[model samples]
Target: MVAAADAQNYAQKLGIIHGLVVQELGWDEDTNDDLRAEIEETIGSELLDEDSDEVMDVVLLWWRDGDGDLVDALMEVTGQLSDEGFVWVLTPKTGNSGHVDPSEIAESAPPAGFTQTSAISLGEWAGSRLVQPKAPSKQR
Candidate 1:
């Protein structure tokens, strides 16, 4: 059994904290319930559903191979973020059913207006953090 302290550490690694609006997308039976619970606990509320129109501070997107066109999915979620928000793309780890190639995520993000910022192992799921590239400064 995973310790609660360890699980909380994992949630913290995703930058989740109290009062942030975290939206969840693509949840299925295969997604990690423990991790989801930890995130909800850290945020002090349940994750907002995909249909929520409120802008989000973080988007937790669960994806898999054969799910859909990742580019489109990323673009759609990007539109729902607050200016400084980001998305965490979680996919099944290697050897698991529905596992996605990391290269596929790397390629898909740029066209959707995001860049891969970091990646971390989340037990059965691997997480990639994506953020929109900062707009270039305007010269006076």
Candidate 2:
């Protein structure tokens, strides 16, 4: 189990802040409850589900090797995201059950209109941050 301080830091590192609406998808028996708790604590509210109609500041996607098509899932989440929001694609870390290769995420992102921003280890999960690329600025 992760210490409270560490869990707090993890949530903050993911850009979660007070009052932010965060939607969570793909929760299952294997999902990390402690991490979810920390996120809820940071946001000062419960995580919303995929069915939520509100636009979300962040989307937490718990994915696995066999969880259908990654591209499709990514695309679906975008409709609920605020323009500046990002998605955290969390999968089991290497050698763990249901671990997904980093290469697979990299390959799937673009077709879904996202760019891989960063990745980090969150206990038993590897979290990959994905964002829609901002349009290039025009200069006179």
Q: Pick the candidate with the highest lDDT.
A: 1
User: Tens-digit lDDT track for model 2 on 1-140?
Assistant: 44676444678778788889999999999998988998999899999997799999999999999999999999998888898999999999999999999999999999999999999889899999999999788999
Give residue 136's error in model 2 in angstroms.
4.0
- What is the lDDT for 59 in model 2? 96
Which residue runs does candidate 1 get wrong by more than 4 Å?
1-8
Tens digit of lDDT per residue, candidate 1, span 4-89? 76444667889987899999999999999989998998888999997799999999999999999999999999778999999999
Model 1: lDDT equals: 0.93
Error of 2 at 83 (Å): 0.8
Every model: Cα RMSD to truth: 2.9, 3.1
Clash pairs for candidate 2: none
TM-score of 2: 0.90
**Alpha-carbon TM-score of each model against the true structure:** 0.92, 0.90
Instruction: Give Cα distance to truth, residue 61, candidate 1, Å.
Output: 0.6
